[model samples]
Target: MKRLLILAALLPFTALAAPLNVDNNPNQPGYEIPSQQRMQSRMLNQQQQNKGMLNQQLKVQTQQQQQHLQNQMNNNQQRIQQTQPGMLNTPSTKPVAPRNGDMLKQY
Candidate 1:
């Protein structure tokens, strides 16, 4: 029949006019707004900058500790040289004077 053919042609268009289900779709929200993407990118950049600063500070602290240890070693070496320069094995610097007990013994 002619009426049945016309009705069938108009039937497919009705489905296209229906409202889309926005809640069930995943790709709809991100494409609609760009501010959320920008915020996430800024947070990632800030974390990387903080990590770089921490590494630089750690290197400076290590250098300072090494320099302090070297200075201490040099100071200790200088002290040892000043305290005992020549007499390492001798116990005391006592005098040897001739007495009556030494005169009876043969030289």
Candidate 2:
């Protein structure tokens, strides 16, 4: 049990000490650091491309929503015009002036 505990403690250190290979090309040396750098750069470019596509989609959706709102506003304006074309020339809310003096006059 003591040996097992010691092996477990040393296992992570052994893994860290081992060389990791990032190169997919079998013709090149496994220790070539440039391949890892290239891989990282490729990943970054893919992320940038994804972001660009998302931005384009967002722009298209925003434009579509804006056009829909504009159409609704135009329809509402047309309805108002058709329903009451002379709304601007509306008469006062007061009743017509009483004719022939007030009926309440004791005359």
Candidate 3:
């Protein structure tokens, strides 16, 4: 029982002492670091490309929105012009004179 316990304790240390192969030996079942690195780089590159495409799409959408707003403003201005063709004339400020004031002369 003591030997079994000692073996179990040394087993973890023995596994740590063994060096994993840098060479992707097909016989060994460990992961290949170089392949993983290449895949990560490819993923990063694809992400950058996707971001660029999104930026382009956003710019196009913004331009379309601005154009739509500008068109609406132009239509509103045209409607206002159609409603009022000319400047409004001002009212006359001159006072009217009273007609036939013979009562005042008699008084």
- Pairs that clash in candidate 1: none
List where candidate 1 sits over 4 angstroms from the true fold. Answer: 1-33, 87-107
TM-scores, one per candidate: 0.50, 0.49, 0.51
Give per-residue CA lDDT, model 3, range 16-93, as digits (tens). 656554355656676557778899999999999999999999999999999999999999998777767554244546
Query: lDDT winner among the candidates?
Result: 2
- Kindly indicate the candidate among 1 and 3 with the higher lDDT: 3
lDDT of 1 by residue, 22-100 (tens): 5435576655345777898899999999999999999999999999999999999887887686646457777989887
- Tens digit of lDDT per residue, candidate 2, span 1-107? 99999999999988976555325455676545677889999999999999999999999999999999999999999888876867655665877788886657775
Range of the 10 consecutive residues with the lowest summed lDDT in candidate 2: 17-26
Alpha-carbon RMSD to native, per candidate: 10.2, 13.9, 12.5
Candidate 2 vs 3: which has more lDDT: 2
Candidate 3 colliding pairs? none
Candidate 2 Cα deviation (angstroms), residue 18: 23
- Ranking according to TM-score, highest score first: 3, 1, 2
What is candidate 1's local distance difference test score?
A: 0.81
Query: Model 3: how far is 29 from its true place, Å?
Result: 19
What TM-score would candidate 2 get against the native?
0.49
